[model samples]
Target: MNNLEKWFHSNLGVLRRISQIGALVLVVLIPILNKNEIYILLGNFYSLSIGNLEIADPAIVAQTILLTKKVFLPLLLAGLIPIVITLFLGKVFCSWACPYFLISEMGAKLRSIFKTPQPSLKNPKPQYYWFIFAGVMLFAIISGVPIITYFSFPGLISSNIANLVLCGIVGVELFFIFVILLSEMVFDSRFWCKYFCPVGAVLSLFLSKNTLKIKLNSVACGNCEKLSESPCINACVLNLNPKKENLYPYCNHCFACVDSCQNYGNALTITFQNKEK
Candidate 1:
């Protein structure tokens, strides 16, 4: 591995640990801080809102919209960063900063206890496209329907927590939340991240030739079939075999395969361009 790859592998464990703790704190604290007031706000926002266009946190959107309209400097910088990152780093934000990824990682770790086999990508199908198509149709028909926003885990969690606080009773939503949490604790988190998350669906469209990609060295992987064990495939949480051509679009560039290659000869490197054959 190159210096940059080595550095990322070395530091990623620490980063994941920190992110997990931070996410837990955010989930627990948000409800405590708002108490019942958050529910009141959400209920009002959901009721009067036009055509499923509920703003779970109007304060956040209002602030961002205001900043974009009034303060050009900050909004410009904020907008530029994601565009630059998408062009250069691809979906590093999804792999690194997204809380859902942390939850998935936690699920992967939990799965280790049962020696749960890595999921297989053989005959893998793209399920996210259907959701994307549905979202588009709903938005086109309903005009103001933010259908994609409804299923967003972050938004759902926040709204549900507020609703629970306001109602003074944890209802069916709580049951669903528990099931999600329990499932994550038992299986790989990426199952939901890959199949569901509209944000991930949106980000996949922006990934281009300039984005960072995981490239496999065919020379080192020539005997993959002959080998009794597959280290890289074994390490992949998304069940992708790097030896395969044209990887699935759901890949978040998590670098688990890079960490799994003990021989170093299987040069599955992350780079801006495909490696020279």
Candidate 2:
């Protein structure tokens, strides 16, 4: 195996957790450093400035453009980076760096330990996510308010982190997040990301036939159906079936399934290939 393959084989899960933790740390650290008068990294998830470069959430950028009816070139450019990245890599940000997703995963672990009567892990129709995204955008346009930003859990969490760091008080958004977390812990897992996250919904639109996605080798996946539960499926916090062809829309490219597949015929792989081919 190549060095890259070997590295991933041994470290995919570790690497993903590191990225998730780093994202959380960066969210808090950016505001703290800025409060110390360091201007190197600025802004929250809605809009982030690293040195002279700006990176922003495309969904929010689109909302701003739609609401204000002006291009605002800098904001457009900031949003473009994420769109292009999403086209290439899929909605990896959700799995690798979204603070809310990290928090939800942690909550899921706690739920597992407490052992509540788990609802069926099957996600509702993926169409509901896009419906929420479109509905929020339409509401923002009609109300002349950026209500879409308020609905973005990642942006809200990051912005609230900054608010607490800089202003010494938490925004009400934190309570919104807590309520959702509590609902998921008690009733379902990944309820928001699977059915309601507008940010993820918007990003998923950028995925194309050639975007990176999970591919399953049916031949290599020997007799996993005979097992009570496949290791790869169990490894996925989203409880996704990595072997399924229709996995892209819901799959976050976390590679947890790929890591788990190593001991079980190495059936799952991440690749950039046209789905039609």
**C-alpha local distance difference test of each model:** 0.56, 0.83
How does residue 147 of candidate 1 score in lDDT?
49
Candidate 1: give the clashing pairs: 104-189
**Per-residue CA lDDT of candidate 1, range 1-277, in tens?**
5887677765654665576566445555555655634532223211212233332232223233443345444433434444456667776656655555666666767767777664464524555455654555455345654544454555455456555655565446546645776776665445666555555555565678768887777777644554325777766666666666546466766767766664556467667785466
Residues 150-237, model 2: lDDT tens digits: 8898889998888988988888778889999999998778788876787887788889988887777777888476443777767777
- What TM-score, computed on C-alpha atoms, does each candidate reach? 0.64, 0.92
In model 2, what are the clashing residue pairs, if there are any?
none
Native RMSD of candidate 1 (Å): 7.9
After aligning candidate 2 to the native by TM-score, how far in Å is the CA of 162 from where it should be? 1.5
- Candidate 2: segments with Cα more than 4 A from true spot: 116-124, 275-277
> Model 1 TM-score?
0.64
